[model samples]
Target: MTRYYRALRLQMQPCGISNHAAAWVTTSRLRLTLPTSTSTPPRLQACRNSRSISSIALNRTNPPESASTRSKDGRQQQNGTCAIRPANREFSTPSKVGRIYDPKMAKLWADTPMSLISETGYKERSDIPPGHFAITAAQNMAHLHNVIIRGFNASYNQCLAVKPDTVDASDFLFYNQGLYKSIKSHHDVEEDITFPSLVKLTGVQDIMDKNIQEHKDFDHGLELFRTFVFETDPKSYDGKKLQEIMDIMFPILHTHLVGEIGTLLDLAKYDSKKLEEWWADTSKKARGDLDVFQDAPLMLGCIDSTFRLDGDPRPFPPIPAPIKYLSKYVLEWRYSGRWRFNPCDTFGKPRPLAFPNPGGSKL
Candidate 1:
């Protein structure tokens, strides 16, 4: 075992992943103590290493296709079907094809016919009059919810698109886990941090009472859906059963997601300064605490970089360019295969679905 680990470390080093970083990912679940280093913190080191290894793993695993498999548009053709192009093909270029927000992908991006939450008629921060923060908060809330909804629909539609026999269950399940974890993590923060903070901030003890109850409305069904996806063996996976479970809960969940936007908008009645403080603090906590391995990638992969807001492109999330670049080039490689199911690419541009509906189902 010692010799094998040494060999693994040697191989990983060429990819620019340090020995300590490799250990962090391979034994992530296990607690380990190492001599403290001044260079980088443990968590950051883990993230950097995971990114390097993921890209190396992807490149090593997916070999170049033969000239015969190349299509006129430069995508690979396999068994007469257009195969998902390699992640590296358009690594430095924005995709000119595939639009996640298009009418064809309505189920993924739209809450109602022709209505996208990202482009919804919410007042901008600058447009708000002095001290009025409700509309800004609501827009931010809507943006976050829209991403989550897109991820859920992406996973749901992918399951529906491919035949069960042909689907890669591991990739599907991991992607589902990312979506599941993202939603659960966000709600957990709300229940544990945001809700209580809001009650104190507004002096309305039950400001989020309806939302809390609504969370209960679909909690069991969501749990069942999560269990069905993760616990079920790949060979025994039943697509129909998965759809049935989602059908029972997702409508209720979607209603809650949309309704929460209204809830934020209604905060106009509260003190604007207090509301702004709550949003600022809570948003920081939420962003800082995301699971870098899963939730971060899931969120980044759902955003639409080209989807402008108030004529400003890439305005959502409000992350800096350096972090965004790291996220796209490095962190995203952590779940490179799982992200294949996401509606948008790592940089948030819409791309062709890795798994498309075989019968051309209008779902």
Candidate 2:
């Protein structure tokens, strides 16, 4: 699959096809059938006629016909809207109102208004029943790391979408800086405070050794990524090069980010009280010295409060109401241009990408 994806990417280079089209081509082939009479496969056909494939991809972004409207029969289908109807109503008759809930048909968000952050394909750490300390702590870490993942992907995709000659480089420069600072700060806190605290709490010297080594795996790539963006003058800024750096770093970074959550979940075997103490200390240290203007915007811009997991929407980062208000109203103004590439609004509402690739999914 990886080799085929790579081959598709190579084919895309000359065609100037967007990532969405490539993904569509790749995934569609699994279920799609073509005329055996055709000499060229549809995958190659798309590359040969880019505009047709682009149009097909763009059409997918149109609002899907409502679930009720998609029934094959002429009968009106009962959907979420039918729940509010009177129980005695003819249309609300239980026998005729069977609703088959398919996880495959479900959406992560109730309303998808934009090009969503690419899914990492890693299943989220499940919520512990009644919530263990491990689950609580891991949830916090997962949310924080989620911000990094989405922020990085949003920045990466936008860089790919826009030509260097067209957009101002400063926006990307500052945007990259925000992504760099947030990710770097996260790892630094883990290594300096969180990991040591874990060892002390568990009395197991290498309790967090694996996670630390995982951090090291991507540290150099992340540093190089950071240095490249910060050091490269905006006059010579290359979005493509920035993307290349991200391409190398993000996979390793993503693996660590996702794997570490499982590590925290494994800590459920430890005493809850001690884990809680460690969490209080580490979480405090993590939030320490936060630059409201810089950090808060990135968090708000990346989080989608509407994203539903375990049948519930996730609230934003647990901060004071005043802090949330101040960050949304005032601090966000500082890097307002950079946030144009952000996947969400100040209130964590998903919004259309400011620079979506041509024919990309706008959901």
* Best model number under lDDT: 1
TM-score of every prediction relative to native: 0.68, 0.62
lDDT of 1 by residue, 114-187 (tens): 13454334454344454478877766666677677778767666675544544376778778877777777678
- What is the alpha-carbon lDDT for the whole of candidate 2? 0.57
Question: How high is the lDDT of residue 74 in model 2?
Answer: 39
Q: Which stretches of candidate 2 lie over 4 Å from their true place?
A: 1-130, 165-167, 287-289, 320-322, 359-363
- lDDT per residue as tens, model 2, 1-363: 334434533332211123443454345333223233413356654543563345456552322357555434432232221111111111211111111122332122212221222222224545443456776666666666667777876776666555553334677777888788777767777777778878888889998888889888988898889898789877677767876787788667777877887788788778888888887655544433344466557777777665543334454354334334444545666665667777666656555556654444232
Global Cα RMSD, each model = 10.7, 19.4
**Residue 259, candidate 2: C-alpha displacement in angstroms:** 0.5
Scored against the true structure, residue 95 in model 1 reaches a CA lDDT of 21
